[model samples]
Every structure is written in C-alpha cells, then in structure tokens.
Target: MSHNINGKAAGKFAAVEQEFAKNFAERGEVGASVCVSVGGETVVDLWGGTADPATETPWERDTVSIVFSCTKAATALCAHILVDCGLLKLHAPVSEYWPEFAKNGKELTTVQMMLNHESAIPAQREPIRPGGFLDWDYMIQRMEDEEAFWEPGTRNGYHMVNFGWTVGELVRRVSGKSLGTFFRDEVASLLSAEFWIGIPDDFSQPIAPIIPFVPDPKMELSPFTKKLLTEPQSIQALSFLNNGGWTPNDPEAHKAEIGGAGGIANARGQVAMYEPLANGGSINGVTLVSAARLAEMGKVSTATQIDATLLAPTRFASGFMKSMDNRAYPGGDQMSAVLGEAAFGHVGAGGSIGFADPDHDLAFSYTMNKMGAGLLLNDRGQSLIDATYAALRA
Candidate 1:
C-alpha cells in the first residue's frame, strides 16, 4: 500500500517523491523519512508510515531514530573542528593530546590515523564489563589497554564501536567537553539541527523503535556477517558484536554518548547538519571549518582493497565515507555507497544515511527504523539518493 506522504517536495524533486512512495509500495519501508537540500535550499522533505507497529502510532513531523554510525560523521566533525581551531593537530601523535593513549603500542598513532580507521585497534580481544559503554571512564581505560590488531600503520580496519571512544577521547581531552556536548555547542546548535549524540533520560521525543535484522537462509550473506555468525573469535565478529551490553533499542543507549554508533536523528535533522558542509562549511554565517579543512574532510584518506572488519572494499575520507563503488566485486553490490567523487559522509548500519555532495551543492539524508539487509546503504536509501541526483540532472 502506498502510504500518504506528509511533507512536500519541490517541482523538480517530484522524482524523489515518487521513489519515496515506491519505498512503501514496491519496497518494504515500514517507517522512514528522507530530506534533501541543494544550493542551500531544502528541495524535498517527506515522511510517513507507522512509528510503532504494535501501537500503529504514525510517524510524525519530528520523530527521530538511532542513526547508528551516521553519528560517526558528527563525531568526526567535532574532531575536525578542533583541528580547524588549532586546538588539535591533524597529523600530531594522538599522544600529544591524550598521553595515556600511547599505551599498548599506540605511541605513533595520529589523530588522522584514528579518523581514517588506521589505528590498528579494531576491537578489544577481551570482554568488557556489562553496560561498560555507558561508563566513559571505563571505555577510555579500555582504549588504553586494547592491543593493536596489526602493527600500527601497516594496515587499516574499521574501528566499529571503539571509534567513538578512541576519537571522542581526543575531543574530550582537548575541548573540555564530552563528544555530544562539543557537537551540540559547535555544530548542531549552530545549525539548528535536531541531531544528538546523547539524549536526556527525560527526552520526551518519540523515537521510532528499530526493527532488528532477521537472517534468511536462502539469501547470500556477507563475509563479515557469515564470520560474525560462524567464527566467534574473528575480528569481524568482535568488531560488531563486542558491544558491552549496549543494544540499539535499549533505553540507556539513547541517553549515552556513544558517538561511533549511537546517534538520534531524522532526515530533516541530518540535512540541516550537513548543509553547512555542503556549502563550504558555513550556512547562515556559522562557519564550522575553513575551506582547507572542508577539502580535507572530503578527500579520500584511505581506500582499502579489503577492509579487515567488513571484508569488503571500502573508501574513507578522514572520518566520513567517500563514494564506495563495490559493485564489480563479488557480493559487493549491496555493500556499495554510490555518490559523487566529492561527496563525504557516513551510513548507519541500517538503511539510514546522511551526506554532503559539494560538487552538486547538495545535502541529503534518509532515516528509517525498519532496517533492510546489508551493512551499507540498502535499496530504500540508495533509491532516494539516486532520485535526488536524477532531479539534479533534470
């Protein structure tokens, strides 16, 4: 059934609206929102469907959901802001900012190395205390104690959950504020966006609960997912599932500052967060970074043949994802994130995504509680992105 869409799309963006409707009819979108801005103007903003399937509560104008690793972009932006302000050095040893991080063979690890996933500490081999993620000091101690997966600088890997603490510590140590507060004060508050790294216990907003992924026996699974199921000792398994009692739907996770993954936002909030990056790091007189820093944020800092964690080809720019076209490789079509060469952002584990394409002067985001298959942008999000680009061409 085609659900009644609740927002408007510009005349040129009719194509986007059609695909948004198609997501409900042809695709299996349960509850979702998509927003796009081009030339500093919001061309499309739309949302529909049930927020809670059990109650059948309809998704409203301000509903938000956990954006997962899309929060990484926000965390990364906080680190880069410090770089832009001369408080942190991009290439300086991370030890310079936080001396304790030099422990366990990480003396040479740099800030950029952490941003680009080259810290060589993908996951800790040991188990963390139950509910350890919520305790910032405990997670910081874990970072200092975790051994390197490979010799630092010899190879790179996606830090998955640890990325928040690894990079967030720098933000905290240098800025005298937690990662979430830095983002709010420096980025979200300035842009008037509704995104949050950590929310309050009394946060009254209705968050659409995320639908968990159900494995299908008939479908081909990713190498990472396969290993995650079979080899319990593998890094692929550890990197993703080693969370110390932090589940996406858990109420505590919503209030904790898990910047690597835990983020809450809707499509409109994401677009507002990205608009400044798309428009040379400033929107409405709020400058988040200099032009040089903006260029560095979008530049491909690392492109790996096969990511150690995902077991797929990946491309990263500092902390954001670049256009990762993996269609030519086996089982990579679903894992790819197709965008302009100049685009940079992060995709949450589910179908959610938010990015800025400077080449097109575009900022776009899609968020949903019902997740599709694959670790990257599933059809629900990719279709909306394709539609946005098609409108730009039109």
Candidate 2:
C-alpha cells in the first residue's frame, strides 16, 4: 500500500491532505484526486494511487476519468450562459424552440421544468441502441416520440441519462452549437481547464479506465438497493442502462457527447470549471453570466420533492442540485452532501463529485478511477470535505 501522494496543501488545509491520503491506505481508493478552491484560489490539489490497476500505471498529475453525472453541471452551465445572454427564457415552453417536442402532451414543458427534472421524460419508451448515444439526431428523435412517465412539470424524478439530451438539444437550437462545442469554447477554453463533454477524436490525454468495485459476497443490500437491483424494467434501472450501459473502457464513448454521464475530467479540471460559480459567475475577467442572472439562476425554483427514479428527496435550482434540507437518502439513511445550503453542483456515479460552496467561497472536485456503490457522496470524498471545512473553521 506504499504509494506516493502528489500535490501540495496550504498550511491551513493540511488536515485535508491527511484525509485524502487516509482514503488510499484505510479506505479502498485505487486512484483519485481532490482539488479545492477558496475565493477562486486553489488551496488544495492532490492526486495519488494507481491510474490503471491492471497495468499498475502510476497516476500522473494529468490523469482524468469519466466523472459520470458531474457532467450535468457543465450542461446546466451552458443553459445558464444562454439565459444570461437573454437568448433563452426559463419559462418558455420547449416547443417554442423545437416544435416536434410539443406533441404527446408536452406542449407545456418549459426549459425550467427540464432543468429541474420535472419534465417527467425520465426513461426511454424503448431502450436506445447500444451505439445510439453517439447519434444525436437519433436520440433526440427518440425523445420527441417517447411518452412522459408522468405529467410534465407535475412531479420530480431523476432524469438520469435523459437530462443531457433534454438540455443539450435546447442549447443546440438556441446557441447553434453542440453542447460539447459550446462548453469547450465558452467554459473550458476560457478557464484553461481540461474538461470534455465528448472526448474529441484528435484530443489525446491520459485517462484511467474505471475499475468497478466488488463488494464482499456476504454483504446484504438494503431493501431499497435490492429493489433497484432486481427491477430491470423499472424506470430506476432504465435510467442508467438504456444508452449502451456506459463504461470508461469504451474508446468510442469518448467521442460522443452524452452530457448527463459522459464528462471526462481530472479533479483540477472540475475545480476550475466550478470556480466561476464560486466567484460570482466569472473567473479571470472572463464573464459568462451577469450578477443579476447568476442570482436568478442559482435560486431554488423546484419544490423539495422525492425523486421517483432515485427514491431520494432532492432539490434543484436551475440545473444544479441544491443542498437538500432533508435527507437525500432512502428513509433519511444518509446525507447527500457535506457542503452548505448555498452549495450547488452534482455528483457523478461511482463517487466522483464537483460543487461550488458559495457560502464559504469554495469550489471542490474529486475524481477517481475506482467505482464505489452509492447514490451520493461516498465516505472517501466526504472525509476530504469534512477535513477541509474543519481546517477552515479551526
């Protein structure tokens, strides 16, 4: 278990580094990196362990991985930028931009409804072909024809794979740019961060293949987890698997922009991407949104409701997940995040996460190669946040 942990920690944030290291030795971290910024300044940037467990490739400073749902935050930002430019309206019916979407009782579906997972198109009527994810037109056509699982804008559910297309198409119609291009040109390039919605054909970078974690055979699943596992036909199951059932090993996947789950980034990349949100919608003199627009976009517009797909009480403002006042876990089983109420961002499946804690002027990101079982912040990531805040408070 002897591995060299790379990167530096500010003297005040030394405890954060300790916890990050502890995850490798004590917890089951195979490869991971954590970056935290305060007042738009990076105070902690750390990476360690093996990048490829099979090849025993040492994790380099630039190693990145597929950050799952954390990609949603980037997609959400694209919409907010358009909103800031007055090019898109939150309350306008989506049919205003894409006429075909108005059919099937969806005439009333608004941009905001889609943003908050209330549009009710949570699952595909028929599972898309394995490679259909790369076909933007094919996917959007499927969405247009699919029936809403519930009345649009009436109930909340985790959109899982669908959120990206719902929002990405809107970005396309209004911005005249694909979500990947828009994000790269507007956000990533300006910030000088290495993040990609779809890993470009010519782009080359060191990316770790996600290593699935195997649990002890004797371990029993909670009732909720058991149901989600056993129900193949349920919305919960379809939400994740309908689109080719993603894996980091798929080289072609990097070339497709599945915004809901297909983001590629290092921990530093995520921190940089969120730093603007932590610093009033701009970083380094590059303005993506006005202060007024930021205030409106960051406000919680959805009622605190349980997600039908995730089966957890959740809250969202615009497109980012707001900290829940109640537990986000099943039966109040676990805390969804360790940040403050003012925090907003997203967690990727398998424990990667990135967020902006405006209350503390902090933006944090954790990315890893090893996948863990959980719908929220796993202890490995939570411990780093707990230590960072504890050090700050002390």
Candidate 3:
C-alpha cells in the first residue's frame, strides 16, 4: 500500500518515499513513521503500517507511540532552556536546586551527572510497584532515602527508571512545577509538538503499548555482568522487571509521569521539537535555548567510559548519544561513517530513534508501535535513514 509523504520537501525526497513504501510491504513493521528536516525545513514525512496488533487501522501521520529513552532528549531540553534563561546551571551540584538530593553523599552530583547517566541511580534497592510511579513525592522520597549503588562520577550506568525521578526532582524544585508541566510549557508548547513527558488524559487514546522483545531465557552474560547482577541492587531491578515493572499496559502507565522513558510522540512532533537543537536551538524565531548553552549540551562528557551500564559501546554527550567513530544510527556503516561525529541524538526502546545530524543540517525522528528484536537501530529504520541521505545526495 502507498503512503503519503507530506510537505514541499517530500517532492525532493522521492528515494525516501520509495524506500518507505518498500519497507512497509517487505518488513514486519506493524506501524511507524519517519520524518526528516534539513536547515529547519522538513523534507521527508512518511508514515504507514498498522496502529494496533490486529493490523486493521493504518498508522496515520498523527498516530503517537512511546519513544522510550528518546524522551530523555526532550527532558534534557527542558533543563537546557532553564540553564539558558540563567535560572539554573549545568555544572552546579544538583543539591543546589534540590536539597534532598544531597543525601547519601550525592551532594557532589551535578546536573550534568543526571543528563549523562553518571549519577549511579538506576533504581531503588527496594523495587517500586507497577503503578506506584505515579505519585511523584513517593518516588522522589524513595530516591532521596536510598543509597547510591556506586560512587557518583566514578562510573556511568543507564539510569533506566531512576533518571526520571532524579531529573524530574530538579525540575520540580527549581521551576516549582513538575517535569511534565515544565516540559509542556517550555518545550512542547513552544514547538507545537505533541510529545509528552507525562501524557495527559485527553491524548491517552492514541498511546501505543510497548511490546517487549522476545526474552532469551538462556541469554549469556559476561562475568562482569554476572557479578553486577549478583549485587542486591541488581537483584531488585531484575525482580521489578520479572514482576512486570516495565510491562504495564494501561494508559495510566503512560500518564504516570516518568520523564526518562515514558514520553509519547509521533514522527512529526518529534522532528519539530528536536529540529531547533539541530539548528542551534532556535526554529522559526522560537529560541528555546541559547546557542552557547546548546553547544554545551552537545559537548562530549568523557567523565565515564563508553562500556558502562548499558552494555553497549555508546558514547554519550550531556543527554544525547554521540555518533563517535561508529555508525550507531541508520544509513549503514558507510553513510554513518561519512556523517561524522557532529550527529547526536537518542534511541528509544524497541525500534524508535531520533537524531540530529548537524553536518547535513538534518533532524530525523522515527517512532514505531511494533517492537523489534535488536536493542539498537533496526533494519527497517536503517533503510529509511539510508534512503533519506541518498535522496539528499541525489
């Protein structure tokens, strides 16, 4: 089936359109959307596949899906805006804004630590119940009272569930509002994007459930991983997942206000929101953050090693992943190799990804309802990205 490619830039990206159509027919994608913008102009906007498992309704351009960790980029943007406004400091110890964070020797943890996943606060020693994340105060208090798994600034671990509480607490303390409120007012409202850190009731109907990849019961782990899992903290996180911590399906699960991974957005909304940062944080006269601060965000943070908690060889900037010497995103090794190190963005769980390639003045976002096997970029997503760059060169 053919899909619609919207906006004027679509005509210039015929290759991209053709690839989208081909993937929809050939790939096992259920529903997804891919969008690209160059020099502040959206070029490729295409979406197709099914919105649900039954495959009855076609995925519309406006169909929203959870972008998992991609929400971190949007959440980071909120903090960046505050920093730009001289209301906060990136390097300042988080305790300066949120005092309770000083507990358990976290007094030295900076805002940058939270963004770079260096805070060592992945989850609580005691597991949190599925729906219990909705109560903001309860979560923050739990974090405040819990001991850090590792010393701050010594290593990096993907703060999976705890990052939301860590960063959201800062947003709340400084802005006198929740992260969701701050994100809605500063980022989403300014860009006219439907992305939500904590989704609202009105938009709940369109949220897609996160389908987990098939679990390999006999998955092998390195010795280091084995020891890490042996820790009491690791056991708690496993128990949470095993007991359905990350598998909640109710719309309220999406609305439970987790800033690190609970965001929901369509392709267009994600593109529109991130294009500003790709083009120096100001789009169409809407300057969400100063160019200087935005540049700081893109600066690489080498305080921690690449092979940290995520178990992936990824280099992270402040909040986004840096496209180091490797091709972490779509477009295969050749295109990503040529794309260089100027690109930065985040990938969501499943197959969703959002990236900004400043070298090409491009911002691309892909969100999908169907979960894929790979943890990193999936095949269908790579094809779309390759087609996008190919079209640009054509």
Candidate 4:
C-alpha cells in the first residue's frame, strides 16, 4: 500500500489532503484524485498513484480517468442549456424534437422523464449487435423502435446505459449538433473545462486505465447485487450488461459519445463544469444558464422512489441526482454523497462523482483508476466529500 498521494489544499482544507492519502493507505485506492471548489474557486486539487497499475506509471497532476455515468451530468448540462435557449422544453413530448422517439408507445414521454429516468425505455428489447455501442445511430434506432418497459411516467428506473443516447439524442435533435460536439463547443470549450464527452482518437490527455475491483473473500452480494448478477433478463442487468457490459479501454471506443457512461475528465475538469452551476450559473464571465434556470434544475423531480433499474430508493432533480440521506444510493452500498438538500450531481460507477451544492456555492469531483464495487460513493471518495463539507462549515 505504499504509494505517493500528491496534491495540495488551501489553509482551511488540509483534511481533504489527508483523506486523499488515507484512500491509498486504508481503502485500496490504487490511483485517484479529489477536487473541491467553493464560490467557484478551487481549494483542493489532488492526484496520485499509478495511472496504469500494470505499467506502474505515476498518476500525474494532469492524469484523467474515464468517469462512467458521471458523464450524465455533462450530458444533462447540454440539455439544460438547450432548455435555457428555448430550443427544448422539459415537459414537452419527445415527439416535439425527435419524432422517432414517439414510436412504440412513447408518444407521451416527455424530456423531463428521460432526464429523471422515468421514460420506461430503460433497455432495448432488440438485441444490440456486437459493437453496437460504437454505432450511435444503431443504438438510438433500437431505442426508438423498442416498446416502453412501463408507461413513461409511472415508474422510476435508472436508465443505466440508454440515458446517454436517449437524452443525448434529444440534445442533438434540438441543437443540430451531436451531444459530444455540443458539449465540446458550448460547455467544455466555453468553460475551458478539460471534460470530454467522447475522447478523440488523437487526444493527448493522460487517462488512467480503470482497474476492475477484486471481490473481497468475506463479502457477500446484497439482494440487489444478487438480482443484477444472477438474473440476466432483469431490467437492471439488461439496462447495463446487455450491450456487452464492457467499458472501452481504448481511445477509439472512448471516442464514441455514449452520453450515460462515456465521459473523460480529471476531478479538476469535472469540478469546472459544476463550478458555474454552483456560482449563479456563470464562471469566468461565461453564463451557461441564468440563476432562474439553475434554481429550477435543483428542484426535486423524483424522490425516494424504488428505482426499477437499481432497485433502490433514489432521488433526482431535473437531470441531476439529489443528495438524499434516507436511501441506499444507486450502487448497492452506502448513503448518498453528503451535501446540502439543495445540492445536485451525478455519480459514475466505481466511485467517480461530480456534484454541485448551490446552497454553499460549492462544486466537487472525485475520480479514480481503481474500481470499487457498488454505485454510490465508496470510502475513498466519500472520505474526501466528508472532509470537503467539514472544511466548508469551518
């Protein structure tokens, strides 16, 4: 467990640095970074350990990681921007933009339903061809043709994989640009954020390869995990695993904008995106949305519903996940990311998280190479969160 955990924190935030080191010392963190910003100013930025465990390459200050569903936050931001521009409406039917989405009983599905995971088209019934994830048109076409798993607004399910394409396509149809391109030109480039919805083939960032978790010998699967693992046809499994249940480790595949899962950023870059949302909807003189829209984005849209996909009580606000203390968070382990009731953000699989607590004017992000089991914040990331909030109160 001997590794160099490198980074610095401002005077009041030394505890975040200590917790970042403890992740490696006590929580099996092979390589990771945690970043926090208050009032849009970075107070903590840290990175350490091996980018490639196999190669033992040091995780440098600029090292990035593939943040799975955390990409949803970035994708969701695009939709919100379109809403701000009046090109998309949250309550409008999907047919308002993408007519194809209206097929197979989805005529009543609204943009809000897609954002909050209530669209009931969590997974495609049509078999995904090998490499279907790389084919944006094919994936969306399948979703367009499939029947809703339930009536659009009746059930709340985490749309594990389809979220990107479903919502991404909505952004595309309205903005006249693909989600990745819109994110680059309008969001990332605008904020000078290093986040990428899709990693280009020739991109130069040093991306840490994700190391899959090794199961603990003494640990047993919870009922939720057991269902997802043993029941291949279950909505949870089908939504996540049916399309090969694989994440692209190479640059080419990473270039595909999967929306829900395909996002690449260091903690700093992720925080940059949230910083604007946290700070009256502007950063560095750029406004992504107005204060009015920011408040709307933070309003709770779904709460304590037993999610059909994750089979847990989950909360979401608009396209953002709410910081709820009562439910077992999405990944079958732990409580929510500690934040103000007014906070919102998204968590990726294996411990990456990006969130904004507008009440505190705070934005936080954590990324790691070593995969942790479950969907919510693991100790490695959660410790950093706890320390960040503690620093805020001080």
Candidate number with greatest lDDT:
1
What is candidate 3's CA lDDT for residue 241?
52
Question: What would the TM-scores of all predictions be?
Answer: 0.98, 0.95, 0.87, 0.96
* Stretches of model 3 off by over 4 angstroms after superposition: 1-12, 215-248, 303-306, 324-340
RMSD of each: 1.1, 1.8, 4.0, 1.8
- Which of 1 and 3 is ahead in lDDT? 1
Cα lDDT tens digits, model 2, 135-249, are 8888899889988888888888888878999999999999999999999999999998879999888877888999876766665453335656898778877776676555667
Q: What lDDT does the true structure give each of the candidates? A: 0.90, 0.84, 0.71, 0.85
Off by over 4 Å in 4: 326-332
User: Candidate 2 vs candidate 4: which has greater TM-score?
Assistant: 4
lDDT tens digits by residue: candidate 1, 1-394:
3365799999989999999999998888888999999979999999998888888888888999999999999999999999999999988999999888887788899998999899988887888789998888999999998888887766778989889999999999999999999999999889999899999677888999999877578878778888999998899888877778788889888999998999999999999999989999888898999988998899999989989888898999999999888888666766888988899999998779999999999999999999888888888899999989988998
Candidate 2 lands at a TM-score of: 0.95
State how far residue 59 of model 1 sits from its true place (Å).
0.8
User: Model 1 segments beyond 4 Å from truth?
Assistant: none
